[model samples]
Target: MTASPADAEAPLSAHHRKKQPEQVRRALLDCAAQIAAEQGASAITIQAVADRAGVTKGGLLHHFDSKQALLAAVFADLLEQMDREIDRTMAIDPVSRGRFTRAYVRACFSDRLLGERSLWGALSVAIVSEPALRSLWSGWLDSRMAQHAETDGDPRLVAVRLAADGIWLADMMEKAGGLKRYPQDFERVLLAMAEG
Candidate 1:
């Protein structure tokens, strides 16, 4: 049989069949979190993540050039998860001006997230401590507050949202070995405020 130009491209297609870059990046991020969860944030080194993901250090580096980048990816993953959770909750009642704050508060109280803040809190504290990611982290915080500025522009509306954030932060800190957690009724009161 005669070989054609398509045959020449077969080798290139075979190379493309390998795992895409995103998959590798996600693997590294997952491994990093697993490491942090099991061994604490200080254990989330590039080699540890690369080993956990079963990828070469170079391959891991290809997706995340340094440990700080990998840590930033973990933080980004948390932000993305929170965003998705908020949107999912917002779908329940989207019309009200308070929907944004309500959804945000409800999302923070998700069964998966409620009272399991140790791992997340520790990782977040470490992520913020990284000099390379501080600006990006701060920007995320800024945008999070500003996101509802149009519908939630009123001081009262903003206060409810900020209060929700404060409540969640305090709850997480309490879980991180601080004082006792806020009263269980706090969520109920916050929901009322959000709806008011």
Candidate 2:
């Protein structure tokens, strides 16, 4: 027999239910990240994230107590992804000196991490404006630097990293203003600098 409309609308069995707490939380974070990447940080409202994730506002709140809290969590998640990317890139480098610096430069230029329309582009402003977010980023940087001090502590390597930061800032500005200021081979130059 065919199922009735009411029966069809009934909730699935426990085994079939996929919206576990952790899954729901991940969905909420993914939705929030998409909104930020597409429309900038100002567009990430609780209601918008809830709608995008197919959850109620209350459900979103149950995962994140406030909008600021949600933003911080999103920022932290991005940092974690970046850390993993850096490690993955570092592993392939046979050079001992400046390996971490080279990996960092590569990660910054990676399309997956900081591409033209990446979440980092959207959240850059928030990182500067929000002290808490800035602190989180600073802490992450500090820890990474400490961990890689032996390999990446040379002044020349530090200069390479600083140059990479400048390139990143320029790229962000180019995205924001539609201006092509940096040359195409900037990454190559930075990588070469990291080598020496």
Candidate 3:
């Protein structure tokens, strides 16, 4: 039997069919991030993200139960992917100094997952709004703080951590005019701090 034109036009990939769920999940998260980047997190409604992703609200719900869930997935995916990329970059340490810490600092500013960082401020606000998430995030932070204090002999470890976060947050909050501009030597400053 000969195939019709419509049949010929059908998608040609079994692999793509198998990956549909992952693709849909990624699309929804990307759509939410784009919305946050464009109009802030308050603009990130389920309907809006569903429409942007070219999926029905029901379709979106199949993957994310609520707006918070979607936002959480987006934020978590961003961090996870950033960690992977930073780890890869850190593996090629030419300077051979504070390899892991420098990679983390680099990841904070040079996140390549999302183009604009407006989503970061949105996610930060979201993380604080949810108590469970807030606890998880703070506990993770506390552990990192402890590690920093133990590794570095500096008595001002708290100040160092806050300053590093301030530098990164300044860049991330650019859309909100939180910081007019990161100083020209911002990365250098962070790198120097990473070394200390």
Candidate 4:
């Protein structure tokens, strides 16, 4: 016996609802990332993303209204992934917040899996608007840093942030081992500073 149209349609609708928005969001970001990685960030456009995702422009817009929103979504998604990874790493016994920072620095530098280049490109575009993206990104970073800075003084936080910045630069340059070449021995010194 053949299934009725109504029964077939019901399963399809159920499958659509079961489709995770987060998964779709990640796929969209991945497409944008691939485009940016190949031809730089300017290659990322609404049409390009839609084509890459095999979705119609209207469908893409349903999830992300504008190019700026899409770019921000990509950045925000990446940050969320990083936060989750850090959370897992910090689940270790006696995981101080500073250690988490250190782990983040190391991970961001060593693992290109985060697609840091594409993210940097996207971030540059987002921040050029100044008011819109900067506020969003700065708020997220500041909140995370502040949460870690609890009970610790500003000096330690600054030190840890500076260390993270250095790690970011080193990672961008593919100089993972060069952290050891710093004259002041930043990894050890910064850890001490954060702990103190």
> Model-by-model lDDT, in order?
0.71, 0.85, 0.68, 0.65
- Give model 4's TM-score versus the native structure: 0.66
Cα error, residue 44 of model 1, in Å, equals 0.8
Model 3 stretches with alpha carbons more than 4 Å out: 1-19, 94-97, 111-117, 139-159, 169-178, 181-184
Query: What is every candidate's alpha-carbon RMSD to the true fold?
Result: 5.1, 3.7, 4.7, 5.3
Model 1: lDDT of residue 177: 38
Q: Which ten residues in a row are the worst by lDDT in model 2?
A: 176-185
Say which prediction, candidate 3 or candidate 4, comes out ahead on lDDT: 3
For 1-196, candidate 1 gives per-residue lDDT tens digits of: 8889888766654245666788888888888877776677788888888889988898898888888888888878877887888877778785768777777667655532434424565575575578756776678767866877776667886777677667656755566332255555666787888777
Off by over 4 Å in 2: 1-9, 12-19, 112-116, 176-179
lDDT of 2 by residue, 1-196 (tens): 9999999999997458775899889999999999998889999999999999998899899999999999999999999999899888888889989999988888777763345468888888888889989999999999999999998999999998898788777767667332245554777898998886
lDDT tens digits, residues 104-196, model 4?
Answer: 554444343344344653355446554666777688778876776653336656667677666555544553343445532455565566565
Higher-TM-score candidate of 1 and 4: 1
Error of 1 at 6 (Å): 28
Model 4 spans > 4 angstroms off? 1-23, 93-97, 112-118, 121-125, 128-130, 151-154, 166-196
Write the number of the candidate with greater lDDT, choosing between 2 and 3. Answer: 2
lDDT (Cα, tens digit) per residue for candidate 3, span 1-196: 9999998899976445554888899899999988887777778999999999988899899999988788777777766675587669767867554555666666665642343544666566566577755665666556644654444435443454466578656655464343445553566686787666
Each prediction's TM-score against the native? Answer: 0.76, 0.87, 0.71, 0.66
Ranked by lDDT, the better of candidates 2 and 4 is: 2
